[model samples]
Target: MNIVFVMIPIAILFVIIAGVVFFWAIRSEQFEDLDRQGSNILFDEDLPAHQPNKHTDHDPQP
Candidate 1:
């Protein structure tokens, strides 16, 4: 049909673009830190507690 002529070229163009993007990602360092982010969530960090009103007489009324 007439649609085949248009659809075929569009599909080919999309495939080529996708391949270019995939290769670009590989060439860049996008996939370098694959495990560091995932492992960070599993461990807990030691953080200081929040201190309130160290040098002021106006205490917070709640």
Candidate 2:
């Protein structure tokens, strides 16, 4: 019975904090581009690795 007094206020505080954060996120447009990040992985460009010069036969050796 004594724990209820403490737990109730804590729970209410947590709920209020969560609501504030949720509203802030909506106002900041945090969820506007939800699919852009996921789709970018599929369409990203991959760069080729660097290769050493292969025409060394005609050049003088060091």
Candidate 3:
């Protein structure tokens, strides 16, 4: 009962802060390249054969 009184105000404050941050990101062009990023992930070209297997970051196991 008493806890709800404390929690309600905190939750409202958090919602206001999150809304402000989202608006700031939109104004700063943070979402401008969303389409480019998705397309880039699907369209990466194959690397050269001589380029020592840069695909996996781990060492090759025997």
Clashing pairs in 1: none
| lDDT order of candidates, top first | 2, 3, 1
Candidate 1 lDDT by residue in tens digits, 1-62: 99999999999999999999999999997899999989987785776566666678467779
Each model's backbone clash number: 0, 0, 0
Runs in model 1 lying further than 4 Å from the true structure: 44-62
What is the TM-score of candidate 2? Answer: 0.66
User: lDDT tens string, model 3, 6-50?
Assistant: 999999999999999999999999998888988887877875455
lDDT (tens digit, per residue) of candidate 2 on 2-59: 9999999999999999999999999999999999999999887895666657785356
Best by TM-score: 2
- From the highest TM-score down, the ranking of the candidates is 2, 3, 1
TM-score of 1: 0.60
Candidate 2 C-alpha error for residue 15, in Å: 0.3
TM-scores vs. true structure, each candidate: 0.60, 0.66, 0.62
- Candidate 2 weakest lDDT stretch, 10 residues: 49-58
Please identify which of the two predictions, 1 or 2, would achieve the higher lDDT against the true structure. Answer: 2
Which pairs in model 2 have colliding backbones? none
